[model samples]
Target: MGFRDRWVDWGNGSGFYNLRVDDVSIQVFRNGFALIILPRYENIESSDLLSHVFRDLYKAISYLYNIGIVVDLDSIKQVNQEYAFNHGYLDDVLRGRPKKARVELDRDARGLFNKLDQKAKAWIDRSYGDLEIETNDLEYARRLLLMPEIIYNLDKKLAPILEELSNQIRLHLEVEERTLSTLEKLSRYIEELRDLQRRPSLFKRILNWFRRWFG
Candidate 1:
């Protein structure tokens, strides 16, 4: 049986299904939501496997209404290395116990799941156009598979340029602030000099009094 069939069978019987593929684990609950635990791996095999799993899982879950999939990318890297090493497989890591897959929201959790399901379906519809593509379209599948590599390469090339631009902006802001501070100090000094000049000097006052007495 296919993975989805097996998962459905188990879920129907137990109200929950848990499966492990490579370094990742997938848990689906009766509420029609799933949690995907993705691990950090530098190897190409792991990356390819992750993408495949994501596509397949999305395909399998797309038929069901009111389902949401939450992907936890950060938590997997925080897993204890020693524990992971001991466990070897994801099923072993869970110790044969299925993790709780239910999400708790205030008062309207089912509504939230339904919203998520609708959004996911909308995205899929936009991407694949009514999901009418032939299942045996190898060329289409090949292009889809290349998407991850394309994104990775683009990100790798763009990161340094983005960092450089950010640094330049920060430096410009610092210079602009210093310039403003200097202008403020200069303005205060000019204002003080103008105030001193406006006051009548002692010599000028004496000269004016002499002129007045002579007249």
Candidate 2:
């Protein structure tokens, strides 16, 4: 069965949703991904630069996943490390798992966790991850993601240039655009997943109160 099939109240607007990217199951509020109106709502072509970016991003994030999140030191201007995932893939991993990702000389430091010997080669139990977007980043992601037309329009406008560049400069501009888009979409997707859970509207809150009081 699909992951959403396990949702408790998927039919209601107030239920939670479970999205399984892999072994990790991200639980979100009802309709959490409903706002993720991505542009070009079609399968990304293998030749598309964005496909490469997405695949690399996923691989980087998943490499040390069993150990925990690999925090990007340069991704945010603020350096505060936040909680992300957990590591319990071994009987002793829980005892020594790093609280968060370690930083590298520059960009993503997820590589730091690659050499951890604490993890067993075999599968084990784990429950150390949380589905969250910083409270401060919600609007940043929501607003940019809501404008799917902009991305589509830009892609259309650049069709000629992209075609020319593919033969000449070899997707330099396209690669930049694809890379940025990949990061933006991932951030927004995470924020969307945490939306209703963090910022329930007044009406929803009241409804929840009623459910509790009446039940």
Candidate 3:
């Protein structure tokens, strides 16, 4: 289901939201803080979906920085496997006698678990490898999840910062343009003065002045 359809209110404008990107499920909980879950799944598209989700998360983080809300990476974990399922599937194997169907089901469950485990590890690496953040830290994870809402409330200050930067760049460019124009005019004037010094009329005027004085 869509995120809006699954949004559940917890109270005080805090609640649960399931944000889906393509086929991936990213669960977000809002309780004066945010909690994000990257679901574990066994599918061919799972890796790509996870990568896309990380990119989206980074975009959100960058937006926060642009708005003067710097996220503390120390408060975020690189890997969190608490949501990863346990080996309850092994219990099914012991429940039935040595039948062909039971063997197939057991094998399938094992394979599914392996795939999910591998995917979860890879997602953790890709998400938090360079950040150097520890995984499974409860407090850090809490701050990381609540980042979106924290930045949202600080949104009012963003426009002024952006406008100030834009104005500074514009002023610099205008000054550079004016400086170039002034240099071009100065160079042209110098060239004209040099040409006048080389002209026959100027020499003639000097000759005439000498003749008038010596005649």
The number of the candidate with the highest TM-score is: 3
TM-score of 1: 0.31
* Tens-digit per-residue lDDT, 63-93, candidate 1: 2222344444333222111000111234444
lDDT of 3 by residue, 1-215 (tens): 22467787778776777545444444455432334444444332423645755665676555445644456765654433432212344445544533212011121111211222222111122232121222233333344557788798677678788899999999999999999999999999999767867997986787788799996
| Candidate 2 vs candidate 3, TM-score winner | 3
lDDT of 1: 0.47
Model 2, 1-215: lDDT tens digits are: 23457565736456765444433334444432211111221234424634644554464345435434343534412211122222234335446644433222222312112322222121222333432222122223233445587788888999989788776766677788899999999999888757755766854886788899996
Which regions of candidate 1 are displaced past 4 Å?
Answer: 1-142, 202-215
Candidate 2 lDDT (Cα, whole model)? Answer: 0.43
Would you list the rank order by TM-score, best first? 3, 1, 2
- Clashing pairs for model 1 are none
Spell out the clash pairs found in candidate 3.
34-146, 75-140
Q: Which of candidates 1 and 2 is the stronger one according to lDDT?
A: 1
Model 3 score (lDDT): 0.49
